[model samples]
Target: MGTQFLTDEKGNKTAVLLPIKKYNKMIEQLEDLHDIKLYDEAKRDDDGTSISIDEAFKIIEEKRKAVK
Candidate 1:
């Protein structure tokens, strides 16, 4: 394991310490996994309704204008 555990006076685990690079890598992997889960859920619930790229872009532009 790429971690060191911090202990309390009773020798019980309190926290953890790991290299910065390893922590960053773990965070990146977790983000990727979350994206995959979202994609899977979207795919599972997908309907036939769809739009072209230009249409989607136009809708996004309109929403941005409304936000401003």
Candidate 2:
């Protein structure tokens, strides 16, 4: 994607202009980065307990049966 800079009278770049598609892609990348940081922080925190996949599936099935 191409970028254009909005400059001031002094020839200093003040802002940037990018295509909407490029801007949206950048936003999505930033969100992904944020999610990765959250995951890293969760990994560092030892206080959280994790459940096995089998146990989780069983619990979900039980809930579905109850709803029906």
Tens-place lDDT digits, model 1, residues 1-68:
68999999999999999999999999999999999999899878879686777999999999999999
Task: Estimate the Cα RMSD of every predicted model relative to the unseen true structure.
Answer: 4.3, 2.6
TM-score of each: 0.71, 0.71
In the range 1-68, model 2's lDDT, one tens digit per residue, is 69999999999999999999999999999999999999899779857688777999999999999999
Off by over 4 Å in 1: 52-55, 58-68
TM-score of model 2 relative to the true fold? 0.71
In terms of lDDT, the poorest run of 10 residues in model 1 is 43-52
Q: What TM-score does prediction 1 earn?
A: 0.71
